[model samples]
Target chain A: SAVISQKPSRDICQRGTSLTIQCQVDSQVTMMFWYRQQPGQSLTLIATANQGSEATYESGFVIDKFPISRPNLTFSTLTVSNMSPEDSSIYLCSVSQRADPTGELFFGEGSRLTVL
Target chain B: QQQVKQSPQSLIVQKGGISIINCAYENTAFDYFPWYQQFPGKGPALLIAIRPDVSEKKEGRFTISFNKSAKQFSLHIMDSQPGDSATYFCAAAPSGGYNKLIFGAGTRLAVHP
Candidate 1:
């Protein structure tokens, strides 16, 4: 198991503003992923942040809207750009251990953003 | 072909009763199945998981039944309690690329005491 810490647990921002959420892991991990959870919905994979490469984004998400930065194996950041009312959601940070073959994930508490 | 469909969008169960949630996947490449539980104002936590190689996996009060031929799986919560009232999500992923998970629409469970 891993312990992940996220900054700005809850924030209220005006439309058109941008916010950067930070994720810090207790130990190094092989894979780091970001997820989004809308109100009363399931978790959606936004992107997979690579240590030194560009993040791999999923369908319906782009780097322009959500820029990711993974400086090292234990730290990463996600910037929600040009926010709108629809951007209000809980952003989560998760990680998978290198030794685990089953790929069990450990999640953070999540940063809740409310775009007004 | 990458979708995981879940049933019973919401459920109400009495304490000490069984709470069952079912899920089906369309992709045969998906060999890893996991269940997540989320409480209000909290992130989703991995509850239990099962692989297609086994028919069922049990962990304490939670059990997972897998049917590879049917492309289906289900979660059983025995002696459900009020503390278990939360949103549950089912996810599927391929063997090597385990981080790329396709999550199903969550099920909201209410275990009343």
Candidate 2:
């Protein structure tokens, strides 16, 4: 099992501003992912943060909006740029261990961002 | 075909009773199915999971029943308690990948004590 820690558990941001959420894992992981959960909604995959390369984003999400940086195997950051009210949601960091084949993912507490 | 359809947007169950949530998937390539539980102001946690090779998997009070031919699965919680009340999500992913899961909308459960 991998333990993930995320920074800025909760933040209130003004429109057009950007906030970066940091995720730090206890050990090197095979995969790191960013997800978003709006109020009363399910989790949505934002992107996959890859080490030493550009992140792979899901459809309907763009780098210009949700840029990701994975400096190494144990750390990554996600920046929500030019925030809007629609972007107010809980952003989560999840990781898959290198030894797991069933694709089980463990998640952090999540950063709750409220854009006003 | 990436969609996983979940039913019963909300549910209210009495303590000591049973709570069930159902989900159906469109993609046959999906072989891994897992259920996650989320409490208020917290991220979702893995509850239980089942593969197509197994008809059912049980862990403590939670059980996952999978029907490969029907392309459907359901989560059952026996002797539900107020502490068990939370939003549950069902997810599916193909094998041999990074586990880019396709999640269901989620079901909010309220257990009355």
Q: What lDDT score belongs to each candidate, Candidate 1 first? A: 0.93, 0.92
lDDT of 2 by residue, B1-113 (tens): 98999989999999999999999998988988989999987778889888899999999999999998899999999999999999999999988653688899999999999
TM-score of 2: 0.96
Q: For candidate 1, write residues A86-109 as lDDT tens digits.
A: 999999999998755467888899
RMSDs, each prediction? 1.2, 1.3
**Interface RMSD in angstroms for candidate 2:** 2.1
- lDDT for each residue of candidate 1 in B10-111, tens digit (9 for 90 to 100): 999999999999999999999999999999988789999888999999999999999999999999999999999999999999988777778999999999
DockQ of each: 0.66, 0.62
Estimate TM-scores for all models. 0.97, 0.96
Instruction: Measure candidate 2: CA RMSD.
Output: 1.3
Model 2 lDDT tens row, A1-116: 78889999999999999999999999989899999998888889999998999999999999999999999989999999999999999999999886554557889999999999
TM-score of chain A of 2: 0.96
Model 1 interface RMSD over true interface Cα atoms: 1.8
Fnat value of model 2? 0.56
